[model samples]
Target: MTDTSIEPSADAPAQLSTLDRFLPVWIGAAMLIGIVLGKAIPDLDETLDAIKIDTVSLPIAIGLLAMMYPVLAKVKYTRIGESLDRRSLVMSLVLNWLIGPALMFALAWILLPDLPEYRTGLIIVGLARCIAMVLIWNDLACGSRELAAVLVAINSLFQIVAYSILGYFYLELLPEWLGLDSDGIDVTMWEIAKSVLIFLGIPLLAGFLTRTIGERAKGVEWYEERFLPRIGPVALYGLLFTIVILFALQGEQITEQPWDVARIAVPLLIYFALMWFGSYFAGLKMGFPYERNTSIAFTAAGNNFELAIAVSIGVFGVTSGQALAGVVGPLIEVPVLVALVYVSLWAKRRYYDTDGVRPRS
Candidate 1:
């Protein structure tokens, strides 16, 4: 449960790994392929179209399941008890649920009010917090994995409930506070809940169950060492493919309304910068080690786009402007975070004297 070896490497490049390096490229390729397929083979579109149930989108579900399997496999549930830090847990909860969403709402309102379409997108981004990609960011930043795991669970729980309730209040009730009219927009709590449950709950449960069973049968060490690392890349690829498909489905919208992308991008960029520095300074003030501080910073900075996308689509319909905002998040998020990883490493060397907690080999 404790990290005692592998100090931070001072000489490593501020760049993505072999797998990470190519992931965005692959994602782009998948999106192009999906668009071509959607356009060329209308039957394929029909087949993809037919694979839906009620509010749940099947292709997204499958992609999420694939994405989560690797993440779940890395989770050491046994360490949950041993690794539990009450202070860290409380800090993460307060930040994600109370401060994170509140700040996001404030920023979105301040930055995105002029454009209603982008404003809805900002709301979706605010509602959906970091769950999955935070882990990758934490790892890159040399943050505490144990704390990341705990935060992921906490945020996921909050997202299911808060995303619905908060989203409703934000879109419906809070408009008056911000001096905006709410007569035309229809926001439903039921729709939000249903989408979170379908997209998040099912895949989360499946991934957890699969991991639990695998661990019980083969043991944790074996599951982590033998199975997870191998399948991790596959899951990542699946997620990218799913993203491409979603984008392709909305390609016409993106192509036609190109200005909308830049509109959402502005607030999202501001939010990311604010959260990154906010958490970083907060961690430094708290006197946490560099690694733990980096972990906290990135965990707070990242957004759970999968959950955001699903909730947006469910709440605003797949073709709505809000869903388009959700889609744009990942496109901006990936490259920025990869750059931040290197920045973190640079900061660690420049600021802290590394006598403890060496970087991983």
Candidate 2:
């Protein structure tokens, strides 16, 4: 078995060094193209609309599965047991489930209560952490890939349980606490579980299985070198395509409610800043090195929208305000995360000695 705790060498091409530099531009272009194509091409919209694959939920599931492989392959599974630091793990869990979500709820309440639709949207965005994109960013920031893999796996598992529990408490129980009635609310917990299972669980399982099989057959080095990089872009493309289709379907809503976009962006911006600094500063205080600190920060900062969207649609109905909020998460997340990667790299130079800690050139 490959030791998952071993960090990949900075020189390894297994990670996307070149693309990381220009990721923001690429993501922006992809979003623009998606929007333009979604608006201009009637047939394309109709085609995406016509094709439905609920049983397998292929696009999102496949995209997620594909995205995780590269990250998982770097796990150094052989050393994974040695890398289990309880302090780091507990801190991350408390921050993600407790601190992160609570902060998001408070921010959304303050910033968006006047706009119900956007308030709900902000909630969805706040609840979901970035499972796929953070790993990529962590790699770019020269963070501990092993820790990232473990966190991603753990987060994926917790998201299903925590999403349902926290979502209920926030959307329902908290409303009651605030003296609001949730009498006619039609949200169902089972639906949330189902969506998580289809979108997150299946894809995660597929990625794990694929990695396991690949490692067994080709060895960890071969799987990481030969397979993961080739498939990494596919995951991003898949995610992009799914988002385009989603936005295309809801183009009219976006067109009509221009302010809704701004509303969604606000809490997201706040959440991103909070998580980034919270993790970075916390890690620094905990005496972590730059590499591990960067990983912790980025991992905490990112939101996993695939799972978020899936759960939002499940809990709030496809056209519900919450689902719309989930849709807008990527709009802000992609660009912001890319920018942070650059910021993290810069931080590395200013704080850590450049002798051995420089990001891959």
Candidate 3:
């Protein structure tokens, strides 16, 4: 029988390395390389664009699933119950589900009100919360690893249901409220459900099974120290490849409407900063310890762009403005969050005692 005992903890030093450290630089390079390749080779880009059935690119689907696998496999679903002690979990949940999506909705409307495609793209991005990367940020900020794991696990479970249901309503209702064209709002539950099932559901199941089987077969030490490390970077490698394909496919849009990328970025930038600080201050006001506060801040601020991009392409099209917005999300988020990792650490130092006490004032 398998031990089924592995769960991510804040206590373990983040598994980040030099390559992981420079992830943003590598992602940026991927974008540039994609753009150049798409522009330079017309036949290659056309061939990739044509390699799709049911509007989902085969290459992209493979890359996204591959990228997602390693990340999902590490989730310690077993530890979720114990990690729920902190009231701050409530704060993080509210931020992720209620506040975060609503804020993104308002920002997208306010910033890109007339541009429905772009607005819808941002809306898609807003609804999909971060599940995996927040763990990395949590570790970097010296936040509660246990709580981060719990929140991520909760989100991981919630998203398979919430993403489709919430997406259906938000995309449908919000446009009518704001008086934008309702065409993009016609996404069906089936579409959102299909995207979630393919993009998130498959990997989650695979992750659970892989961990269960591997631990049972090889014991914990070999599974953790050897097996885990080998598969750890698969998702990132897949990300680079997917980015290349996405940008290559949309090279024309990128080159012709260069400002579109910047336009999509505005709401994302505002969203990231606002979520981080808003949650940070809210946690402090509620008297959460620094550890819980940082966890809340990063969890609120980060997004699962992989799911967002996959869903956008599934629901919208690969070359859609929505997909473009989804692509731009991680592009802007990584660097911004990288800088904010420091901000979190500095804030930890400035406002909290070394013992995780919140400063008065």
lDDT of 2 by residue, 293-349 (tens): 777788788887766666556555556677677767878877787788777766666
RMSD of 1: 4.5
List, residue by residue over 1-361, the lDDT tens digit for candidate 1: 0121124566544333466546556666776676566556545534554578875678877776666556555555666665556666676676677777777777767877777766777777777788777775666556665667777767776765677677767777888777885422344556555655654566567666867898889987776667665665766676676766766666666666778777778777887888888877676666666766776788788888876776666556667777788877876786677678877878777766664243322
Q: What stretches of model 2 exceed 4 Å from their correct place?
A: 1-17, 41-50, 55-57, 180-229, 355-361
- Considering lDDT, where higher is better, how would the candidates rank from best to worst? 3, 1, 2
Model 2, residue 262: distance off in Å is 1.3
Preferred candidate (lDDT higher): 1 or 2: 1
Model 1 has an lDDT value of 0.67
lDDT of 3 by residue, 1-361 (tens): 0111232232222444656657678878998888888788876655985787675567877877877677556655676565566577677788999999999988988888778888888888888898655665665556665677667767766776688777866787666676656445445556555655666678778988998998899987897778767886776788778778867876667787878888888889999999999988888888787777887799899988767776777667767788788877877886788678767766766776656675557
Clashes (backbone N, CA, C under 3 Å), per candidate, total 5, 16, 2
Which residue runs does candidate 1 get wrong by more than 4 Å? 1-8, 11-17, 27-50, 183-224, 355-361
Which candidate wins on lDDT? 3
lDDT of each: 0.67, 0.66, 0.73
Q: Cα deviation in Å at residue 230, candidate 2?
A: 3.7
